[model samples]
Structures are given as C-alpha cells and as structure tokens.
Target chain A: MKSLIVVMALSIATLVGLVCMRVQATQSGKNQESAVSQSTISSDSNSELAQGAPANPQTSSDSGRSLVLVASLTVFVLSVFVGFEIIAKVPPTLHTPLMSGSNAISGITVVGAIIAAGYKETGIGSFFGMVAIVLAMINVVGGFLVTHRMLLMFKKR
Target chain B: MNALVPLLYLVASVLFIVGLKVMSLPRTAVRGNLLGALGMLLAILTTIFDRGVTGYLFIAIGLIAGTVIGTLMAKNVAMTAMPQMVGMLNGLGGGASVLVAFSDLLNTSDHHVDTLIAVGLSGLIGAVTFWGSLVAYAKLEEWPQFKKPHSLPSQQLINAGLVGLNCLFIAILAFSHNSAIQIACYLGIAISGSFLGVFLVNPIGGADMPVVISLMNSYSGIAGAATGFVIDNNALIIAGALVGASGIILTQIMCKAMNRSLSNVLFGVMAGGGSAGNVDEIYANVRSTSPDDIAMILDGAQRVVFVPGYGMAVAQAQHAVRELSKVLEARGAVVEYAIHPVAGRMPGHMNVLLAEADVSYDKLKEMDEINPTLDSVDVAIVIGANDVVNPSARTDPKSPIAGMPIIDVDKCRTVIVIKRSLSPGFAGIPNPLFAMPNTLMYYADGQQAVLDIVKAVKAL
Candidate 1:
C-alpha cells in the first residue's frame, strides 16, 4: 500500500508538472494564433474575481467530513440556479453548440473517478475506479475536442 | 494544502459557469470551451493531490487510453454524424457515474442510509442515461432494429412498473444493513433501471428525438450529481447540477417548439399505426421543376428566404446555399435564412452547418422573426426540410405535428422545396406544403440542386 501510494504520488506530481508545461505551451501558441483573441481570453478570466465568495475555510474543521459535504450541497444548489440564469437568454442558433459544450463540462466526474481509482485499497474498487476514470476521461476529452472543433467553424463575418 | 483544495474547486466551479455563459455568443465560444477544459484540468489535479489516492498505474493507463480514443473519435467524426456522437459520449458519461457510484457503494463497509439512497439513485439514473443514450445513438444513426420506434404493448404500463420496481429496490437497499442483500438490491436496481431506460426512449418517434436526446443529457447530469453526493465531491456536484438544470431547460425549449409536453413526448407513443400506403398518394401531387425555371422566378423576386433542415446536413449543402444566397444578394434580391427552433436533429443544428459555410450570422433569422413577414417574401426556398414547414402543423388539429410552430413558408408568394422525394419526415406524415399550388418540388440531392441553382442563377 505504501509503495503504491508513493508511486501514485510521484506519478501524479509528474503528470501535474507535464500539464502545467502544456498549459504554458498552449498559452504561447494561443498568443501567436491571434493577439486580439489572446487579449480577450486574459480579460475574461480576470472578470471571474467579481463573483463573490472564495472557498469557505470552515469546511476543514473537525466535523470530519459532513461539513465539507454540506458545503458541497450548498454549492451544488447555487450552481444549478447560476447555470440556468447564465444560459437563459441564449439565442436559438447557439442552443446546439452550447448544449454540447455544457455536456462536456458535466464530464467533470473525471475528478471523482481519478480520486476513486487512486484512493481505494481493494482490487475490485480499483478496477471499477479505472473503468470510471476511462469513461469520464473519454467524456471530458471527446466532449471538449468535439465542441472546440465545432466552435472553430462559428466565425463571425 | 487543505485550504487549497476547496479554493481550487471553487475556482473550477466559477470557471465552468463563466465558460457556459460566454459560449452563447459565437465570438467567445472557443475561448469559453478552452476555459472549461482548463477548469476541468485544475479540478482533476487538485483531487489527485488531496489525499489517500494511490493507483497511479490505473490512472495513467485510463487517462492515456481515454485521451487517445477520445481524440481520434472527435477529430474523425464528421459534422453530419455529430448528433450520434454526442449521444454516444453522453452514454459514456453516464456509464462512468454508474460505475463510480456502484464501486463506492461496494467499498462502503459502514453504511449510512443517506449514502445508500444516493448510490441507488445514482445507479438508477446512470443506468437509464447510459442505455437510453445508446438507444438514442442507434435511432439517430438509423440502426435497423432501432430505426423505427420500438414499443411494447401497453408501453406506459410496463414503464410504470419498471419505475416502481426501481424505487422499491432502492428502498430495500436503503433500509437493509446485510451486505449480501444490499448487493443484490443494487443489482436489481441497475437491471430494472436499464430496462426502464430502453423502454422510456424506445417509444419516442424520430420526430421527438431532439427532446429525448436533451432529456437523456439531463438524466446523465442528474445521475452525475447523485454520484457526487455518494462521493461528496464538490466539483462533481456543482458541475453535474449545472448540466442537469441546463439540460432540462433545453429539453423544455424543444418541447415548446414542437408544441408538446414532456409527458406527451415520453409516454405518448406518437407514431402508432399510420399507413405507409398513403405516401404514394401524397407524392402523386408533387410537381418537379428545373433549376433554370426556378432561377427565372428568383430573377424578379424582391425577397427570398432559405429554410434548411437535416437534408441540408446529409447533402452537405450549406456552402452551396451560402453561395446561392450571395448571388441572390448581388442581384438586388433580399436574401435571408429562416431557422426553425427544432430545425435539425439537434438544436441550432442548421446554424452550425450554415456557420461552417461562412454564412453571415445576421443573415440567419429565427422562425418567429421571419414567420410574421413570410407573406411579403417573394420566394421561400426549402432545402430538404419537411415537418418544420408543413402547413398541417397549423391547419390540421389531428396531425401529429398539430399545434407545433413552423416556418411560415407556405404563406410566401412562391414556395420551392428541394428534396429527393415526397417522403414524410420523422412524423411519418405527409407535408401538405409540397402539393400546395405555389409550392414547387425540386427533386434532387440538396447539394446538387443548390449548386445547380447557383449555376443557373449565375447564367441568368
């Protein structure tokens, strides 16, 4: 178990490092693709700060776990409303691409699948976790790639 | 490290909402997709680093295999096959949730009632979404066995029974503490739910597919949320809830467009036993016209509206349509594209196809915007569309598409329909618009017909 944990930790760290490098590469590549678009991306990300509430630190207290669970439920409820509100006024023409895009976002279950695969002790749990991870990754990767490919065609003018 | 985990998830959640918000406009949609992808990456990395996870080999293998398979499929899939692809991927998403939620339940030595309930619900919803999505894919791709609506005798009763059995199994598992019994209950819930999924989606006719697909998308999201509760992951919960709500809204929009309720869509078994023999009678009235003669009609027309449907996608005719529109515009004819809300297999399907052909966004007009002034338009050119423009939608109360809103092409001075045959749409009902006095059927492949028209118009 200890060996597995060490190997897992090392691999995760390495993967994270690789991901960061790839992100940097993409950012540079994006800049070269279009300076105007690059400016818009940076400006859009900054606006995220205007939304209220960073993570509530109280979730980490000795209630052991349910506190975090409760906090999660709260976030879940709020996000449903936000999701509806954000997309309410979308024109009919964008309904297809937008739905496909959001379907990709729901593949966020990859995070849970990864955690399940990595955190379990028994072989059965690990096997199911691996399957889950693969499926979720497929959703995430396929959903995003297809969406991006589709979006590339939606040029103005 | 602890503070960082929640903070990262929060950031991820914010990014997802922002991404979806900005995606409404074509200009920022690509960036929105990128932001969402980045958010997913952050959330996954944070979860891996949090604690207790140790199966690096499995994670690595899954990630690599998934990335390769997903990338290949996404890059290779043609735009015309996109609906089936989306349906297939949605099934994968649901399948993942089912496995994750089931495994988590299996690993649980100490049982909480709430956890059991969550697991059961997730398993039920996930299985339904998974199998339902598969059926949707088959239907869309026209798999022989699934091509027609497959319904049991008294389908509503059977579906109700399946639903009841699923709830009963969940209740038994939630109350039972015995491990063996609980496992059996879980299996029961999954099997019953899978059967329910097949039954629920099988009854829906092809015309109602957009709604079914949208609803299945919602089911997957709801299932993911239930799984999040089982695992207590904030990112999964938030993201799943967002998709769940958004999908339901999209489904409602489709239903409204079709003038049907959710129940009518799911349980109505709409296709029934309509005779196929009448198709011959219907087509006897179709009058075929050459592209040159139609071009002559367009030579003097002041306004022209192009209505495109699934046939446009099949024939890959958007570019031809765009070119033809440009020619018409240059000839001092006002040209615009009228889009029915449920025009194609998926929402905004026509827009995506047109956008790909570099059709100016403003030239595409929604149904309501164009319907009011359709009578003033000199020519309405329908490319491979059927039900969405059928006059039966407004005139015949007994028609399957009765009360559904459609592009008012019939009211236009001259209606030109470009289609291969006088075939019915998904509804298996004849379109009266094809035989109307002003309507001219240009029987040809959508692409060939449009290209020929473009050439003919150029010659004129």
Candidate 2:
C-alpha cells in the first residue's frame, strides 16, 4: 500500500513535468515560427512526393525526436494510471465485458494501419499495410460487437 | 480541417475513458459498450480523413471484409466459446500491431534511434502476443494436442535463449543504419519472439488459462503502445496504455484469487502435486444420492446457493441451472449464485453464461460476499463445480489448492454436488467436502441432473 502511494506520487510528478514540457514546447514553437519556416517549407514541398511521410521529419534533430518521445511516454504513463483507477472499480461480474471492451480499444492500432495502407506508394508497403488494416478492423469490429452482445445479456430480472 | 484532427482524436479518447468508467455497473454497461464503439468509429473516420492518407481502395476493401467477418463472428459465437473468442481477438490485435510496425519501418527512409527502438519492441512484443494468444485459444478450445501441458527439455533455458536473441536483434536494428540490416534484424526479432511466446504459454495447464489470457491481453496492449511510439500518435498510445493497465489489473486479480504467484502460474508446476495417497481415506465416508433425494432435501430449504464452475460450462447447464433456481425461488427458497473469481475458463465466465440464461446480475454474489452468508443457506447446490467448493482448501495445508480461497459451501446445512463421477477436478485431488457427513453427491450430467431435480421439486 505504501509502495502504491509512492508510485502514485511519482506518476503525478511525471504528469506535471509532461504538462510543463508541453507548455514550453508550444511557446518555443510559436517563438521559432519564422526561424523554422524554411524547414517547414522544405517539408511541405517534399510532402507532395513523399506521400506517406510522418508528421515530423524523418531526419528530426536529437532534441526534437526526444521531445516527441517524452511527450508520447507521458501520455502512455498517465493513461495507464487512468486505466487502473477506472478498471479497478469494475466488479468481478463485469470482468469479461471489461476485457472484451478494452480489447476493442487496443484495436486503436487501426489508425496507424490506415495511414500505412493509404500511403500514396502502392506496393509491398501498401500490401502489408492493407493486411494490417484488415486484421485491425476485424479486431475493432468483432471486439466491440461481441462486447456489446455480452453486455446486453447482463439484464435485470 | 487540419486543426480538427487532433481535436477529434481528443474527443474520441475522452469518449473511450467515459465508456469504460460507465461500464462499472450492469445497468449502464450496454450503453457504455456502444459509447466505446462510437469512439472507435470516430477515431477511424478521423484517421481516414487525415493528411497523407491519399489512397482509399485498400482501406475500403479491408473495412468491408473486416466488417462482414467480424459481424458473423459476433453474432454466431456460443456463450460457452467466449474464452476462445476473446483469445482469437487478442491474437488478431497483436497480429495487426506487428504489420503496422513493419509497414511503418518500410515507409520511413530515415530513422531516429527512439523510433527504431520502438519499432523493434513493437515487432517483438506484437509477435509474441499473436502466437501466445493463438496457443491460448487452442488450449481453451481443447484441441487434442493441447489437451495436456507439454514442456520441452529445459523449457525455461530455451525461453531465456529466445529472449536473448530477440534483445540482440532489437539492439542491432536500433544501431544499424543500413536498411537491409534493419529489416533483417526486425524479422529476426519477430521470429525469436514468436518462439518465446509459444514456449512460455505451452506448458501452462488449462486451470491457469485465465491468467495466461489476461497477460496476453496486456502484452497486446503494450505492443500497440510501442507501435504508437513508433508512429508518434497520442490516441494510439493512450488507448493502448489503458488496455495494458486493465489487463494487468485483471491478471493480478486472477492470480490473487487462486492464491498463487504470477511466476508459479507461468511455470506450470502446480499440477500433479496434490496428496493423492489420501484419496481412499478421504472418500471412505462419501455418500451418493439421486435427483429425487436432492429435491426432497430442497423442498424444506428456505435459502439455496448455487455454485457453478467450468463443468457447468462444459455441459452447457446454465439455462437448466437457472430453471432450477426459478423453481426453488417459486417455492419461497431464496436463490442466489455464488461465483468464484476463477470459476470457469476465464474471469466472469459463469456470470456471462448465467446472464445469458436470464439470470439477473444482481442475484450473482461474489465469493467474498456470499461466503459469510453461506452458513445460513439451508441447501448449497454445487453444480458441476469442484475445487472452488473443496473444504481441503481450508483444512489441508499440504494440498496443492491449500490457502486458496473457496466458496465455503461446506458450512451450509446441506451440500449437494451434481457431478458425473467421483473424478477429481482440474487440481486432480479428492475433495473431502464430498465425504462430509452433510454432503451428498448426485451422479449425472450437470444439465440432466438439474432438469431431473427441477421435475422432482415441481412434483413435490
């Protein structure tokens, strides 16, 4: 229990740190708008040909990449905390539906699969991406529908 | 329109969280599921409209095919087969993550060290989750080859070796600048991770499937999160982390319910270690009865508690059990179900089966909730359940299931166990509860026995 408290406190600290970092990044990004306009222009010019380029540049500097990583990690850790708190309140009776519902949520990978499949280059990459999209769509559709079916059964007398 | 993408994603994320929060209660759970589906729909639509997604042919085909298949599966699956259904879905989710990571790796020409590491981790964990979930599905479906636990020589050593190989590949993939070397290392990591998954889950017995499935669910989530990192998507990371956390909590709950450590369950060493020599001694006073006799006892009972297990699921006796409970309740006998945490092939298995039979969720009492009131129960009908009701859990320290929490049905005035034979349960140990002076065993299929008792009770 003490350890749980410590972990909670640590996570809260991390959350604060992440929020501060995001604020700083946004402020800095606004200040550097003119300075980075050249790089932005170059990326926009490449975007037409590159087709499936990521939001950030592939050759992002070390600090830029690390910032993205840190932001992503922050979201991951905080979301986990939210998951634990909400899911722990679920009774044993709803365990199955909770599992199937959350299983459906993991199908969020479909978003990534979509980008991969719909990328302009239609070749081996698109082929595998299409397959991934199909698989993820199945997970999303089947998982949600099945969970709904099961939940519909937990009725009153 | 470009600014709306992140805003819409944020909405979807909030919807997902609200959906899960509202699902804590049965009355609101159905709506909660629908809300979650809405979030998924929103996220999918937003992604489709996002910049760089210029091609739509493959997306259209994939979505149509997936919807058709998914609808059929959701509509046609039997309640008894839910464990395998969930297992299959986990495997597919993991499989999708692996392909997403692969496609991301191929599409990007330049790679940052962090993105490369994330890609490697996603491939490894996703491949492991996919194969491990398939093995779990096969085991749960009771495939002939997987009916019994199988272990290779020095299984742990082999698993460790596979982990080492995967780590080495991930390191090389992260450091390597050559596209060919990176791709090769990625494939190598996936292959080794697949083997590690199979080997890790293969030796676990059927009784530990709940833990295995939950852990796999967690792995699938972590894999998705890794893919999120690879692609730099906040929605994917948040959703995946939520699932990862949910699975971990469920796995911990299951392990605690069985009074076994996670490592003990994973090692698959819990079986065949019971005190078999005392079986005859324990069964010396075992008493047998008929359905009519059980009905006679039930006729005078004021309160009854029904304990259902995996055997109830095996016989598909939930409806019959519900019928019996209705008959008992009509006669002024208070009827309630006592559900153990790890009752069936998965967590909440019995509740789902019973709920399908029109049994109200409110009537279902958890083990900790019902155990104290069991002594007041005039009749405890343990249908197709064994280890959960075994008194040895409380009495015998040397027993494999000792220290595990049980239903304490033995404390009731009369205990009626409906089973086919004097056979032991998954634990493979004789239950002294069957031999207690107040206990009576009725031999028949769970559904048949319940039907017979219902008929006899109606006649009485």
Candidate 3:
C-alpha cells in the first residue's frame, strides 16, 4: 500500500512536469512569433530590429526544440506507466532475467552515442562518442545474451 | 526515407514493450528476449541512416569490438557469478550514458535551459550509476578491500556533502553562458556524482546487495532517459523509462520480501538490531544427526522440501541437491524447493543455480506458495539456509528479524538442517529454529552432506 502511494506520487510528479513543459513550449512559440512580427514592423528601432531579426530563426528553433522535449517527456512518462503495469506481473522466478533484460534496454543510449560519434563535430566529442558506443553496445549485447542463456536453462519436466 | 526512420523507431519501442510483457511467463520468456534483441537491432540499424551520421568507419569498429567482448563475457560467465555480471553490465550502460551526455554537451551549440538541465542530469545520474555499480560488482566478486562493509563515522555526512556539490555544479552548468565554464561544471557534477555513488553504496552490507543492485539498475535507466532528453530521441526515452520502472518494481519487491523500507536499506541500517535471545540458550536443545539418520527419515517421508541459501551457492551443492531430489522422487517421495525471495546474493539467485543443474522449474515454489503447505510436509531439509527459516521472525517479536516474512519450515513434522556450524546469518542473530525439538542438525558441507544423503538413501 505504501509502495502504491509512492508510485502514484511519482506518476503525478512526472505528469505535472510534462504538462508544465508543454505549456511553456506553447507560450514560447507564441512569444517568438509575436516578437518576429513586432520586430519586422518597428522600422524606427532599426538597430534593435536588425539584432532581433537575426535571432528569430534561432528563437523559433528553440521553441521547436521545446516541442521535441515535450514529445519525448510524454513518451517517457507513458512508457514508465506501461513498464509498471507490465513488470508488476512478472513472477519472482524471472526477476533476475527481467533485471538483466531491462539492463539491455537501458543500453538504448547507444543510439545517441552512434549519432554523436558519426557527427564528427569535435575531435574530443567523437572520441568520447566512440567510447560510449562501445560501452553501450557491450551492455546491449552482453545483457541480452546473458538473459537469454539464463532463460534457456529454465526447463520443465 | 526520413519519415520511415521515426516510424521504425516507433516500431522498435513497441517491440520493447511487447517483449517485456511476454517475458512475464516462463514458456514465452526466451522468445520475448529474442524480440527485445530484434528491437534493439532494428533501432541500431535505423540510426545508421540518420542525417549527419557520416563517420561510418568508427561506428563499425565500435560495433564489432563491443559485440566480440560482450559475447565472450556472456558465454564465459558462470551462473554463480550472475550478480557480478549484471552489475558490470549496468555499469557499462551507465558509463555509456555519461559519455553520450558529455559528447552531446560538447558538440551542440544550442545551450537551451532544458537541454542543459537534461545534460546535467544525464551526467550526474550516469556517473553515479557507473561508479556505484562498479563498487557493487567488486563487493560481489569478493575483492579483498571491499569484502566487508566499509563505513566511516561521517559516511552519511560525506555523502550528503557530495550530493550538495553535484547539485551546485548542475545548477551552474544549466545557467552558465560560457561553454568552457559549462563543460567544467558538467565535469564537476560527474566527478562529485561519482564520489556520491561510491560513498552511498560502499557502506551497505552484503546482505542488502539485491536492493542496492536493483536501485543501481533503476539509476542506469533514469540516466538513459535523461540522455534521451538531451538527444531528443523518443526511442531512448521509451526504452529507458521501461527499464527504470522495471528496476523500481524489482527493488520494491526485494525490500518487501525483507520487510525493510528502501531508506532502511540505503542508510545501511542493520535489519532488526533488537537484542536477540542468547545464542547458547537458543541452541541448547539442538540435536545432531548423520547422513544415515537423514536417509532413514527420508525413506519414510511422504513429502519433502529443500530450502537453500547463499551458502548452498558457496558450496556449489546445486547439482548434489538435484541428484538427491531425483533419488527421493524415484523412491515415491515428493520433493520440491521452497525459494525465498532474498535467498542468495541477487534476487532469484538460487533459482538460476538450480535451473543450471536441470531442476524442473515446476518443483520450485515461492515462499508464500510453500509456507502454508509446510505444515503438511513430512520433512523439511534445509540445505545451508538459515535466516529465511528462522522461527524467531514470527515468534519472537523482540528478535532482530522480527516481522520479517520467512518460510515456516519449523512447522513441518520433522526438520533437517545441513550446516557447517551454528554461526548466525547475515543478520547476525541467533536462530531459535536450531533449538526446536523437532529440528535435527546434519553437520557437514552442503555438497558433501547432500552427496552423503544420496549415497545413504541409495544404500537403504
């Protein structure tokens, strides 16, 4: 019962955070558009308008980036709920495999690492990215294979 | 093609969820794992076509090298070393997150508040998980320096200070305009977070490893999710959240089984520090029995159950126990294993060991499942297990392990305990079960005792 309360509290907190971020993104989007339009028509403040006009694209992208954040947060929270519902049903016998299997899933960071490595933006960044790729892949491959090996051993008469 | 990539990622996320769902059942678990791997492969392949990913040579090299190393580790690890293996893998995953977050922070020109915060979180949590898991792995592997729980008088204070330092670093990183200063703050967060992790996990006792490992697993997942937010990838977010939730559930289960709270385990509070009854007084009536005597008891026993613990793993007696079970079955006796949730170093540790020895999964019953039926069993053979079967948990309210859920092995008609000595369990409390009138002690190594019992039963 206490654990249930903790879970509910966590869910509520995550939802609230995501909702706030979504609202912030929408507001920022509106603000950026109004700023762009206002700067365009205010010809008397030419210097200010010139400086602000150049940053319009960047501000617009910032809002766009926030939208992406909102989307990702939505996915994260929903997947957490799905995880709770699905994982709760797993019996004790499979707990170890569940842990190792999920450990493999966390290796999804490898996707981010791959992009980082292949972007070639900075020499140090690529170096770290390549190392991250190796580490994440080890987690992916090792975690899954070990779990599979353990699962295969569970035979019934 | 670009649209198809997101669609593929969506498909991969769904596959991961479906795979975890399928893993709930034993029969479909193997297929479920394969499906997860398939999803992973799909996600990786799809990422290769991502725009701006031009350095294919490095990616190929990393993939090949990682695969070779991962496969060898997976193939060569013994079942007994599973906890260590999982810990090591968790550390690698976390370490990877730290690197990815650092790389992204360095490469991206966009210093958005949200992105910087996410980057800070990814670095902090990832570094903590990596360092903490390495400590856990070393403890499990029984490194001499870490074999015993190490604690200082100001351990918690030190840990709190580190956490404060990390948070300060993260905040500076988030609001800082200078990239160089931002990078330094990020490094500060990682370094402080690493020390925080080490300090937090260092003092925890060996018996609390299951909870610690589960918590570390959750941290790794959360770190991955933070990295996902940094990279703005839904696939990573989804997968990381699933793992995070799964680890939380497992940690909750472990804590419940031990009747301890998460905080209790984390703060290194020894379970039930209440004054236990005197050791000599508790074991005064303890009766000793030999293998022949145990065999004679088993000869006429109609129902028998074996309770195993970490000591069984130490003795490597799983195969011997299986042999004994087979012999008992041939003699028309029922044999089943009563598995306690926190029995070995990790959750489900004993079950994996028994599975490796070809024991049928059906014969393994959970603590709750077998407790009610223990009264009807003719004999309960406790092979190296102690605390789980201790009657004090139920009878002695003042005992250290009071209120903890334990197998009611003492309720059986006859109880046979195979152990080397009367030493206390990880809880360091004397067990009154050893002194019960119906309980008989068979003093020997777990494997030797089981093998002797098999030989004696055959001779009978």
Listed models, DockQ each: 0.26, 0.45, 0.37
lDDT of candidates 1 onward, in order: 0.78, 0.83, 0.83
The candidate scoring highest on DockQ is 2
Candidate 2 has a DockQ of 0.45
Q: Native-contact recovery for every candidate?
A: 0.67, 0.74, 0.74
Q: What's the lDDT of the predicted structure labeled candidate 3?
A: 0.83
Scanning candidate 3 chain B in windows of ten residues, the lowest lDDT window is B271-280
Report how far residue B191 has shifted in candidate 3, in Å.
Answer: 0.4
Among residues 3 or more apart in sequence or in different chains, the pairs in candidate 1 whose N, CA or C atoms overlap within 3 Å are A118-B53, A118-B54, A119-B53
- Which candidate, 1 or 2, has the higher DockQ? 2
Per-residue CA lDDT of model 2 for A1-157, tens digit only, reads 5424634553454454344434434544533421221101222423332554333333324465466567677778878888898889999999998999999999999988888888666767677888988888888999999999898888554
Better of 2 and 3 by DockQ: 2
Q: Which candidate leads in TM-score?
A: 2
- Per-residue lDDT tens digits for candidate 3, residues B201-273, read 8988888999999999999999999998887666788789999999999999999988889998888568544
> Candidate 3, residues A5-95: lDDT per residue as tens digits?
5345444544454444445445555443222211011222223322332112246456555665666676787778888888999988889
Model 3 vs. true fold: TM: 0.91
